[model samples]
Target: MAGESEYTYVVDFDGTITANDLSLELAAYYGGTGYREIENKYRRREIPIKEWLRQMVALLPPDLDQLNRKALEWVSIRAGFNDFLDQVREQKSTVVVASDGFGFYIEPILKAYGLLEKIEFVYRNETVTDSDGQLKVINPHAHKICPVCGNCKAAHVVRIKETGKSVIYTGDGSNDRFGASWSDQICARDRLAEVCDEYELSYSPWEDFYDIIKIEKPDLKDCSDISLCLPQGQGIKDGI
Candidate 1:
């Protein structure tokens, strides 16, 4: 029942939209020597992203303004991202940004590049200072039952799909596999591509957003078999 032009591009922030992973960079800059240990744990899959955020936040200073300032200075938008946004707007398609990182600087970074308004939605977690004056990560968009991602990108993909819009997921991290698995098409790079390969999922490798613009908008397919989560049914994968 959806129009031919009804398509949603579910994009990842951090390394996907920006040239570097701001979250990782920030954590490394402020988290100091201990940052490497936490990061290694995450890379080894010993801890999910939600747990990573909790542990990482503990190392960051409680001054959000200082963190935001650093993020603005270090943020760099990926090549062709602005053009891709223009093309999507011209085609009447939607762009939704999904990030499972620290997430406080996403808006500031996008607005700095004058691309915030181009996106239809941003699904991300919040970094807040608790009553005890410590920085903490709050996952308002997380899956209630799944402890994997701080912000459940898979749920965002399924929500758009249920509205009859075809979704094209784009990302560059290992955590992106969950959302990419639910998408009609996957545009992956870096760790995301590696994970897709590991899972035997079909995906297009991309270096920049220009490559994304050239990717054919895919027709909606039955993704139940390949998806890690059944949004309408039993929720996340059995062991995940």
Candidate 2:
């Protein structure tokens, strides 16, 4: 018999994990008008994310303390993440938080909520302040298309597929468009639903992620956390 294919849940941070858009929130909170213009360029793909961010950072006033502090203050993670993850563990499922965003923000945010260690992350790097008082985004590049992401959602989706497992993806913004395209099953909200509609893909709309726990290990609805009971166990997390 074939072994069970591991179930991987790939999630995006910024808009998806957090209830608020951290990038724009940080940009506008500290960067003001300059941030808005660069944001437009990001949406239009007029400039690469690195370049767009470079220009945005240049405009930030030279107040190291202010930028560092404000970076995390305005961002808001979803209300039920802790509960959602608890349920994932209850179901004994593996979870990966993937993004094109920096860890400086991601790491701290997770730490704030005591979730950094519960999952592994694949993402870009943290920010640094150059001696000249300019900001630098220090991170390795992503896949050709992923680099352009507001959060590199698609690259992680591809990585999960390469593992030869069944994947479930979730998100709530245009950032999710590329990632959702490759998912075996998708749960979406806001613009992500719009993206799925345009692409003719099937997706479920979710208001909060506790709904995700209910659907874990898809073949085992209403079963205990370990739903591998032989009756519901056929195919289970194992792929076709």
Candidate 3:
């Protein structure tokens, strides 16, 4: 079968892949006082997410090895995720991880799960040491006005849609908001589920990914059949 003819899935790394956002968890573990300050600023809208990320990274020591070690030690792949991924593979669906978070943890976590090579693509912040010996946050796209805390998931939606492939998205936080808004189907939990209800978007709360492997619902549910379906004109491309 042609690979492009197969389905494509874009997953959010933090809460979607694991149980929580590794970047947020990383901040609590590494950023110290500077992290709290940035969080408050973001909550208050005192700074745009782009600038906040710029500032947040400025506070971290340029310790790539240390960060990688910590991520390997504490980060976890969500329950049932590996099996769900395998099911996707069995069906010839491509899986991509698009994250606003840094790549330091993502690469290692996927490696730990033996999924690093299988993932189709990864979009995230790069790592570099700054003049002050702090890790610098590098945004290749230098985005502006992200919908979530510090990055724009919407942009990823646009990129994925450009391929004109059928896409499925799974996530937990509002970071997946605009992206979920564009998916052919979406599975979410907690805040994102609430967002779906409020916006009347197509979505369902996922307990874990075991159902994805064993059940037929997620892969078969059509957004158009639901009352909460987004308008025909929203999302990454022509909104279809």
Candidate 4:
């Protein structure tokens, strides 16, 4: 079995870590009621995800600052996430947050929790305010062929695997399908779990980061001697 340091975790933000999906929340709150209709079309496969993302962005107001503030105020991470990061740090493992959502809010949310430096890298869409004060998305990591997720999580996972470290992916969204396929191990829940089921990919179902730590570091499950894991009975809320 591979030890903790032998793995590189490529994780998803939004629904995976946060108690809710920030992008969808932003769209529903700021993008208007029609946002759900557009999302439904994408979910139903009536329209491509690229177009769905574009339409969602179009619904947001021009104030990037306001959006960032709203995200900071509303964003809540999974319980025991801090403990998981501590373990990753102790093992010196690489953990990357790869998401299709814009980074404008992600950066701030991570910073707020003092977990910004704990992440090895972040791959996501860049957001900027144009001269006309409108929100614009800059996708540097998008694959021209894939056209679904603005940022290609699978590409990053493949690159990490080339470094000789096993990749472990954790996610809870449809956008994670390709990346989950590329990972050596998958820690899935909610929507991503359903996707894994359809493809018959073996995965470890998780309710939160605690479940992940248990599977990834079983020896540390009862490591109360170390402050690496949360105290038992201190349960965390999971929206899913």
- Show model 4 residue runs off by greater than 4 Å: 217-240
For model 3, the local distance difference test gives 0.66
lDDT of the candidates, in the order given: 0.91, 0.63, 0.66, 0.76
Residue-wise lDDT of candidate 3 within 91-189, one digit each (tens)?
A: 877788877676667887788779887777887777787686768777764345332234455555555555666567778865566667766678878
Superior candidate under TM-score, 3 versus 4: 4
**What C-alpha lDDT does candidate 1 achieve relative to the native structure?**
0.91
In candidate 2, how many Å is residue 85 off?
Answer: 0.8
Model 4, residue 186: distance off in Å is: 0.6
What are the runs in model 3 whose C-alpha is more than 4 Å off? 1-4, 43-48, 141-152, 214-240
Worst 10 residues of 3 by lDDT: 227-236
Cα error, candidate 1, residue 181 (Å): 0.2
Task: Provide the RMSD of all predictions against the true structure, rounded to 1 decimal.
Answer: 1.5, 9.2, 5.2, 10.3
RMSD of 2: 9.2
- The TM-score of candidate 2 is 0.76
Consecutive 10-residue window with the lowest summed lDDT within model 1: 231-240
Which candidate number would show the highest lDDT if scored against the true structure? Answer: 1
Clashing pairs in 4: none
Best by TM-score: 1
Best first by lDDT, ranked: 1, 4, 3, 2
Give residue 164's error in model 4 in angstroms: 0.6
